[model samples]
Target: MNPIEARHWISAEDKDLKTVSFFHLSFPEQRAAFEELIQHTPAIQVYDTIWQQLQELMKTRHPAEKLSPDLLQQKAAAHIGNGPADEYGVWVYYPWSQRLVHILDEAEFVEMRTSRNQHKITAAEIKTLAAKKIGIIGLSVGQSAALTLAIERLCGEIRIADFDTLDLSNLNRIRAGIHNIGLPKTTIVAREIAEIDPFLKVTCFEKGITEDNIEDFLQEGGRLDVLAEECDSMDIKILSRQRARAMGIPVVMETSDRGMMDIERFDQEPQRPLLHGKVPDDLSYTTIRQFSGEQRMQVALNILDYDNISEKLRSSIHEIGKTITTWPQLASAVALGGAMVAHVCREICLEHNIPSGRYYVDPDQLFKL
Candidate 1:
C-alpha cells in the first residue's frame, strides 16, 4: 500500500486498541510473558517505582507513628514475602506507548494513589464510590469528565461511547494531542483512564449510543449508578434520559455554554419529567430524528432556554452559517463543564440531595463585580 494508505491503515487499527495489560511476575506464565515482551521489544521503556510506592504505603498506614528507614524497609520486605522488588507486584504494559510500568498490585496501588483524598473523601465513601458504575455518552466534554472521574478513582467501572474520531477541529476543546487525530474518541478516553489506573474497568461503545444499543449500554453487565449525557445529538440527549428514567438511574448533562448543568434525579422521582419538563413527553425519538435543520435548532434552543444563555452565545446563534460554522466552544468552558459533571456524578452516586433542575456555574456572572 502507498505510504498515505498505510498511515490510514495504522490509524484504523488504533481505533480498535484494547485496555492496558497487566502481568503478575509472581506467576510463572506471566513472568515468561513479560520476559518474552522485553526480548522481542528491545526498545520498550521500563519503569520500576514499586519501592517508592511501598514507602508511601507504609507511611500512610502508620501516619501517627514514626518509623526509621531500617524499620520501613523491613516492613516493606515482609509485605512482599522478602522477594526481589521487581517480582513483588504487577507489571503493566502499555502497547500504544511501548512502555512497561512496575507498580504495586491493585489494592496497594489504589491505597497509595488516593491517600491524599483521605478526609476529603472518607474511607467509607471511597468504598461506596468504588462499587458504583458510570456511563458517559459523549467524548468532547465527556472526555474531561471521564478523566476527572478516573483521577479521583470515583467509580469502579466506566462505560464511554462516541462514534466520532479525533479531528483537528476538536483540538480546540477536546483534551487530546494532534497525534491522536483519526483515533476513535472512545479509544482515546479509555486508554487515558487505563494509564491512570489499569485496575478500573472501562467499556467502550465505539458506535456511540443508538436506539439498538442504548438499552444494553444502560443495563448490560449492571445498571449504571449515574449517566453523564454530553452528546450533541438531540435524539440521543432525549432518548438516553427516557431509558435512564425507566431504569431509575439519575442523569446529568453539562452544556459548555455558561457551564449550564441539568440533573434529572430519575432514581428518586422515576416520574420526573425529562429535562424538568422542558422537553415534551409527546416528543418521540422518531419525530425528533426527522426534524428539519431549522426545526432541530429551534428545539435545541428551547431545551437550553434561549433567554438564559450568555449574550455572546445568543448573538453567535444568528451567525451559525455566516461568520461561524457552528456553536462555539472554548477549552476553558469544556474543562469547567467536565469538573461540574464529575462533581455532580459523585454526589449522586453517594446519594446526596442534589435536586432535579437546571443549574448554571457561569464564571462570567460569578466573577462580575
Candidate 2:
C-alpha cells in the first residue's frame, strides 16, 4: 500500500473504536455478520462467558423467589427463548482490539454489571443517572474524572475535549501508556471509556474548546448536565464557566493541588460570579488571553487563592523558570481528584444539594501528625 493508503487505514482503525458492534445469534443476518467478522479477522480473541453471567443475572433477579439451582438454570434458558447456551446473549466485537466478547444484551448486561451497586445506587438512581450527560475539558486530570465517571456508570453520555496530544511527561498522572504518545488526549480518554463500557456514548472535541465551538459543546446535542473544567488554559477556564453560567449548567473543576475541588452551580444561581468571585469583574477571557506568562500565573494563583495552596505547590510555582518547566502534579493527587470530581458530578446529576463552593480533601491536613 502507498503512504496515503496506509495513513487512511490507520485512521479507519482509530475511528473504529467510536462504536461497538453487537450480534445476536437469533438473527440470521447478524449471525452471518459475526461469522464473517471472525473468519477474516486473523488471530481474533473470542471470549464466551455468557452462561455464567446469565446465571448470575438470574440470581440477582430472583433474590426473593428462592429457586433451586436447576430451576434457576431453566429460568435463564427460558428467558432467552430456551436456545442453546452457545447461541445465547449477544456477541460484542471490539474492532480495535480484535476481540469478540460474548455477554448479555444491553439491558441484562447493565443489570449484571451494576448489580453490586445495589441499594447504594438503587435501581431508580441508576435509571436516573442513565439519562444524564456530562462534558469535560482538558484531559490531564480530566482523564481520571472521565474514566471514574464511566466506571461508576454515572452518566449515559460523556463529551470530552482536549486538543493536546499525549506526551512522555503526561504518563506521570494521565493513565496512558508510552505507545499512546502523539495521540490526542481526547482520543485516549474516549477509547478507554469505550473499552470499559461500550454502551456509554462518548463525543470527542479534537480541536478543544474555543470561542467558536464552546456553545456547540455545551448545547449542540443537549445541554450538559455538568461541565468538568480541568484545562490548563486560563482563558478557556474562564470562558467555559461564562458560557456554562449563561446556559445555567453546573461546572466542576479539580485543581490536583491540596485535593481542591471547585463546583460552580450555575444552574442554581445563574448570576453567580465566576470562581466564587475569585476572578474580578474586570477580568474577561479576551483580557486574560493577552496577559504575559507572569501575568497569567498571577491570575491563576489569585483564582486558586495563593494563601490556600499547599506549600509544595507554592514552592514549585517559584521554580517554574529555574528548576521546572511547569507546575507539578502527583499521580496520587490526580487520582484523588478524579474520584472526587466523579462523586460530586454524580451528586449533582442526582439532584442532590451540592451547592456552589470550594472543598478540599487534602491528605496532609487530614492525616497530620
- Among all candidates shown, the one with the greatest TM-score: 1
Q: Which portions of model 1 show Cα errors greater than 4 Å? A: 1-16, 67-71
Q: How many residue pairs clash in each candidate?
A: 0, 0
Candidate 2 residue-wise lDDT at 60:
88
Position 192, candidate 1: lDDT? 87
Per-residue lDDT tens digits for candidate 2, residues 1-369, read 111111111122367645567777777777777788888998899999876787788888888988788987887788778467767777777765788888877787788767888788999999999999999998878999999999999998888888888999989999988888988887778768766777788888888989999998998878999999999999999999999999999999999999999999999999998999988755788998899998899889988899999998988899998999888999999999999999999999999889889999999999999
lDDT of 1 by residue, 1-369 (tens): 111110111122444275466777767777787899899997899998787788778878999989988888778778878577788878888888888999888888888778899889998999999999999999888999999999999999999998999999999999887999998998888778878888888888888889999998998989999999999899999999999999999999999999999999999999888888888977888899999999889889989999999999999999999999988888999999999999999999888889988999999999999
Clashing pairs in 2: none
> Listing every candidate in turn, what is its Cα RMSD in Å to the true structure after a full C-alpha superposition?
5.3, 4.5
> Worst lDDT window (10 residues) for model 2?
1-10
